[model samples]
Target: MSVAVIGMIAGMALGFAGYFGGFGAFLLVAALGAVGFVVGRFLEGDLDPGEFFRPRDDRRR
Candidate 1:
C-alpha cells in the first residue's frame, strides 16, 4: 500500500516535470511499483524502521 502511494506520487512528479500524460503517469507508477516491491523484499533484512526513529528502551528491575 505504501509502495503504491510512493509510486503514484513519484509518477505525478515526473509527469509534471516531463509533461507526461495520464497514460505515461500510470505506466511510470506501475513500473516503479514493480521495481520497488522487488528491491524492498530483497533488502528487507538490511532495514529496521524502529532503529531509525524510535527511542531506545532502558529498564532495570
Candidate 2:
C-alpha cells in the first residue's frame, strides 16, 4: 500500500483507540507508534543509531 493509505490506517487506529479508550491511550498509541517507526527504520538500515545521539547545530548566539 501507499504511504498515504498506511498513514490513514494509522490515524484511524489512533482515533478508535482514543474514542474507545481515553486520552492517555491515545498518547500511548502515538508514542509507541513513533518508537516502532524508529525501530523499523533502524532494522531496514535506513536510520543510523548514531544519528539519534549526534548533536545538532541548532544553538545560536
Please list the residue runs of candidate 1 whose C-alpha ends up more than 4 Å from where it truly belongs after superposition.
1-21, 45-61
Residues 1-61, candidate 2, lDDT per residue (tens digit)?
8999989989998999899999999999999999998999999999998887766975656
lDDT of each: 0.66, 0.92
lDDT of 1 at 7: 67
Lowest summed-lDDT stretch of 10 residues in model 2?
Answer: 52-61
lDDT (tens digit, per residue) of candidate 1 on 1-61: 6968876887666666456556676677667767776668658866555555665664445
Give the lDDT of residue 18 in candidate 2.
Answer: 100
By lDDT, the best candidate is: 2
Number of backbone clashes in candidate 1: 0
Give the Cα error of residue 38 in candidate 2, in Å.
0.3
